[model samples]
Target: YIDFYNNNRIHSALGYLTPAEYYQQSILQNVA
Candidate 1:
């Protein structure tokens, strides 16, 4: 059972990346 909004979810508003991925990318971009 998965909570679609909380897990295994990809957001189109974030360019189709998962929330975790989107956050990680933002951090990397800021650091670089």
Candidate 2:
């Protein structure tokens, strides 16, 4: 069973953003 909770699918924990998106946003924030 693939755990598509937040990591692969929309996660309510991260404001409905996937892990990749959240990570990318974090990186972008740091860069700026």
Candidate 3:
């Protein structure tokens, strides 16, 4: 599923985090 890939699939280029996960974590880091 699209949601699964964007929010759950791991990508090595992203340190094994999904695209959505990486984006969310980055945003949180930026805000802190």
Candidate 4:
């Protein structure tokens, strides 16, 4: 359930991205 919430569910507040996707994008942006 937790995994599905973070990795599969899309969130409008995060621009329709899953929480995991949003976090990964932010990490990559910071690394670059």
User: Which candidate tops lDDT?
Assistant: 4
Q: Model 1 segments beyond 4 Å from truth?
A: 1-7
Index of the highest-TM-score prediction: 4
Local accuracy of candidate 1 as per-residue lDDT tens digits, 1-32: 44566346888999998777788899999999
Clashes of 1: 0
Q: Model 4 compared with the native: what TM-score?
A: 0.88
Flag the better candidate by TM-score, 1 or 4.
4
* Model 2: lDDT to the true structure: 0.79
Report the Cα lDDT for residue 5, model 3.
81
Those runs of model 3 whose alpha carbons end farther than 4 Å from true positions after fitting are none
Candidate 4, 1-32: lDDT as tens digits = 99988999999999999999999999999999
Global lDDT scores for all candidate models: 0.79, 0.79, 0.93, 0.97
Off by over 4 Å in 4: none
lDDT of 2 at 18: 89
Count backbone clashes in candidate 2. 0
